[model samples]
Target: MSKGKRTVIVTGANCGLGFESTKYLLSDKIDEWHVVLACRDESKGKQAIQQIVEIDQEYASRLTFIELDLADLDSVRNFVTNFNQEKLPPLKALICNAATQAPPNISTTKQGYDIVFGVNHLGHFLLTNLLIPHFAKNDEINSIVNVTSDTHDPKNGTPVPVPTYGPVDKLIIPPQETPKRDSRYATSKLCNILFTYELKNRLDKSDEFKNHFRVNCFNPGFMPETSLARYLDPKLFNMIVEGEGKKYRKPIANSSRYLADLVNPQLDKVSNGVYYDGNEIIPSSDESYEVSKQLELWEGSKNLIKTETDFIL
Candidate 1:
């Protein structure tokens, strides 16, 4: 690894928005940076690399793969441990782009937690916490981008409908009453923003890492063809967009491009813990920014991962 070239790890890079973001980030015009296209399947990772090479040869070498399966905590632990054990240079960017919608049933992880809660929230939460120390190693503007969704809206002040994440030990509505089809997914995405705010506060207050990293979250809007859309009932994704998201629903490519720009932009002034969809830092509902609630969510995440990993708090 070149000491001067920054490295970024983007999860779920095999297809859809993740794939598009990888393509945009590796364009020939971009700077010489290393992008670890973290994926569950190594073969697909190679395919992605090949596709990028067709775009530009130099971009091929800049992209590499690190196998990761968010549903498995052991996989998460092993990936981080291997990376840390190698004592590689400090990390530059960690993008949490992998996610899932409500499982067909109440699926459980290897650790027996709900699947969406496991992959969409806890998995990235643990990964980011484990890599915090690496960020503190340099002062060259480290970033952690959490890709959230726009569905978690504010009804008056409270996020009207929330999912049941037992691990987080907080519920806005009972699990049975909660709209499992779509609202469940929205709740997890809301958890992403809350996680970002809590983690940003940790970075800002830490004497050891205060000046090293910037934590922010964003929504890519409602993209119809992404892998996450596969979780919805047939035609449901498009139907919902037509009903409530007609104005904000965007093309997958455009969403990916906007996310790429957000990840590595030329802007000089940006706020931490803000959620950006494209160019706009859209305001989250009041509940999403509840400072105390954010802290509680952070602690819950840490405790969940602590049992399986050796990451420092």
Candidate 2:
């Protein structure tokens, strides 16, 4: 790895938005950046790197892959340990882009938390906290971009109705009774916003982090072409995408461009805790802005991480 090059970590980077964002980051001044593809599958990660190298030979040496399974807290901890051992350049940005949608049936993660919530919110939350020290060491402008969705807002009223976010206990665990699969997915996305809001608040309040760090969330809008809908019934998923989902659906590249812009070091200024729809900064759901809910999620996340991963934030 280059000693002085800026470094970034993109989770779920093997395909879709993550892949496109990685390509954009490496498209110019290739040698000036080192990108770590944090993927759960080694084979797919290697394939992604190979494809990028073939297209952008100038930056082939700057790309690397590291295993990261967000479904398991132990795996997240291991990823951090392994990344620290590499001793690469100071961390510049962390893009929490990985997410999962469950089938009609309720599923649990390896640690027994709801699978969607576990991977989408809690996993990324822990990962960001663990890496803050590394980001703090760098004086350059640093950022954390959480890839959220417009569906987090109940007002979207597309694909399916989004459920209202509840207390932390319900948010983290599978309900005693199974909820509609789409509701679970929507709840997880809402948690993403709440987490990002709380994180930015904490960072702003901190003397060490207020000026050095910026945390924001992005809604990629709807991208029906991606594998994100793989868990849905094939016929139904196709029907929705071809019909109602078609109008709002954006090309994966468009979503990536929006994400890439957020993390671009060239950008002059970025506001903390802002939510973006494509390139525009917009207000999120009113519920997402509730300080009470944000703090509840924050405290609950800390407790979960401490108990599940034996790591204190």
Candidate 3:
């Protein structure tokens, strides 16, 4: 492992926004960063790396792949364990970009949580907490960027309404299945913001973390081309992408530029807990700022993690 180089981990980096962001990081600032492409499928991970290499072969040495299955808590633990065992450089940023939009059917994780919530929120939540110690060890400024969506707030005029509400209890034990997939997905995105908000507050309160660590969330706006909408009916998805969603939709690379900026260490005066809308710091949903709800979500998350895994944060 190289001691002086900065390290970054981008989860779900095999394709879509994650892949594009990884490419931007590696291509735009190759000399400074060593990126870990965290994916559930090793083959897809390798393929992503190959594509990056084809674009710029010089980056091959700086990139590597690690298996991460966000749907399973055990897989999350194993990824962290393997990461620690490698003794890499102090982590500079962790981009929790892996997320899922469930199909019209009810799906559950290995631990039985709703699939959308499990992979999109709970999995990333646990992964971020597990990596906190490693982040704490870094003397340089670091960040944790949770990739969220505008759909998180129904008031934002998302094409689909987010029916489910939060407070941890309702989020963890989803009221229904199948028909509520879109709502569940929206709720999970909301969870991402909530998690980031609560985490930033906690980090700010800690003397050890206040100076070195920053946590923020990002809304990539709407990228209709990404595989995130694969579960939707193709004809409808394409029509929406090409029509109404077009105005909101940005090219994958354009959306990724915002993500890359958030990870930049030299960027000045980033307020903790702020949400970014395509490089602009903007206010998130009002519910995301509720202090009581943030605390409830934090404690509730810890409880769930303890119940599901041997490690507790």
What would the per-residue lDDT of candidate 1 be over residues 1-313, giving only the tens digit for each residue?
A: 2422667779998887788888877762544456777788889988988888787676755777788888888898788876666443346788899887666655666887667677888889888877777653643677788998776664422222443333375432224422444455667887898888888877787887786676788878766666776655666556666676566668877777777766563434656678886668878767787777777777777776666445555
| Displacement of the residue 1 alpha carbon in candidate 3, Å | 11
| Clash tally, candidates in order | 0, 0, 0
Candidate 2 per-residue lDDT, tens place, 7-63, comes to: 889999999889889998786463366789999999999999999989967667788
- What's the CA error at residue 185 for candidate 3, in Å? 1.1
Candidate 2 global TM-score: 0.93
The whole-model C-alpha lDDT of candidate 2 against the native structure comes to: 0.82
> Candidate 1 has what TM-score?
0.86
- Ranking of predictions according to TM-score: 2, 3, 1
Can you write out model 3's per-residue Cα lDDT over 1-313, one digit (the tens) per residue? 3332778899999999999998888765543677888899999999999999899777777787889999898999999988878666668899999998875565777887778888998899888888887773654578899999998887887676673656565666644656633587888888889889888877877886777877899989888767888778888787877777877876777889889878778776665679998878988888888788777877887777775444333
Show the colliding residue pairs in model 1: none
Off by over 4 Å in 1: 1-4, 28-30, 84-90, 155-167, 170-182, 241-243, 308-311
Using lDDT as the measure, what is the rank order of every candidate, best first? Answer: 2, 3, 1
Which TM-score value belongs to model 3? 0.92
Per-residue error (Å), model 3, residue 254: 1.7
Model 1 lDDT, full chain set: 0.71
